[model samples]
Target: MTDYPVSNAAQAASSAYRLASLDQEFLLGDSTRGVRFQLEYQKAQEALRAYGVVSMLVVFGSARVRENGAGRQAFWYAEARAFGRIASLEGGALGGPPYANVVATGGGPGTMEAANRGAHEAGAPTIGFNITLPREQEPNPYTTPALTFRFHYFAMRKMHFAMHAKALVVFPGGFGTFDELFELLTLSQTGKTPRIPIVLVDQDYWRKVIDWRALRENGMVSADDLGLVEFADDGADAWAILKRAGIDAAPTVNNFPLGGT
Candidate 1:
């Protein structure tokens, strides 16, 4: 029997047409419109795979943040920065390490850039999966060339983000940040993926989002559902929790003792 499941020639041609349109718009170059977004996206994904990242920590937060903004957006940036550093250390501790990097916001400014900058400061490769937006989104320069990416498809980008994620560190932000964070939660709650660690930095910021106690009281979610999310006051605390959860192996033996003995 032939491998082709469809024996109808007309049906095959129709399918090909749909794929061709998508290719021209999202996966292939269409020079007629002077847009190479799709090509750039594929290039970025390939680059990230080549950068030796076996797993990644997807850092989600505000992209419209100013260093001196109202609210705690700046603090969120600081927390993400620290989280990136912790991700690098966790990467180093794992056996047969493949150098996990913190995949940041993928934009030039805001918390995404901060995470990438933190990884860069620690001399680690970082991934910035930038999306094409109307404005205020540019690829941060700190991303390692082979670890940076752009995507024409947000869904595809989200898939790639979750693909190699060992953990997720969420910072306080707006709608987009909430969407990404909840989607990850949904996936975990539904058994779409293994129970990886999800650290929500800053209890004050996240406490307002949902009342777990209320959910339990109303029987919407089990008491165990609360276990799905852990809160932290800062980056170091978040790292501590994630490290203990087996997202990556932690160093068991003390390699370097106190002072020169």
Candidate 2:
């Protein structure tokens, strides 16, 4: 006896559409799905490729930082803004001779925007990798035309953020900020990335979340892991850390396309 083959739906999810639902499901045929995905992927690839030579400083922080506030909360925003400005000024006017010619940040509001604004104030090009969110993630107006990007995939975006990140400055924030910080630390810890300087601004605020002594006492992390990050009380110190990392100033002045290096 001869056996017949199963239908396409049984073989693949792409062919999940019912025969009667075909006309209502897609204006383009299922065959176009792979092509469409490839095209979108290429756009993302090109966007990542456009950022040439600029050393990235992924600024992670809260989006809810008040347009106005005081104390630690306010200080976090102020300091991040300052970090952006200093990086740009030193990297641009002072010449990033040994460093890449730009500064970059998450392309959203709060600390990210502050960092971008700081770079813009210093008259240096800056980048903003904005995430697509249902609310509160519009790309700030400060991002330079050639450097701004929007990403649907956070992992892809995070990869790009860490790709050339000469340093990382984490300001006080919520889950998202912490998530970014941990990822960088994990990468460095796992040897997936180099031991770049990781700065956490507002030591007091950060302390509330992590009990360093307990971490060590419990043997949850290695002594080397503890050394992976430094805490800063202000922007001046944060900028100083980056400067010490050979990103202080550079000789060149051209966009190197985002992931080229």
TM-score of each candidate?
Answer: 0.74, 0.77
lDDT of 1 by residue, 1-261 (tens): 467876766865574556655654443544533245345545655565465455677788878765667778778777778777666656552232355435555455778877887777777777788787776467877777666666666776776666666778887778998888888887778777666788888887688876778988999888777788899898888888876886554322211121113
Which structure among the candidates has the greatest lDDT? 2
The whole-model C-alpha lDDT of candidate 2 against the native structure comes to 0.72
Clashes of each: 1, 16
lDDT of 2 at 242: 69
lDDT of 2 by residue, 193-237 (tens): 776789999888888888987898999998888999898889998
lDDT of 2 at 194: 70
Instruction: Choose the strongest candidate by TM-score.
Output: 2
- In model 1, what lDDT does residue 215 have? 87
- C-alpha displacement of 108 in model 2, angstroms? 1.1
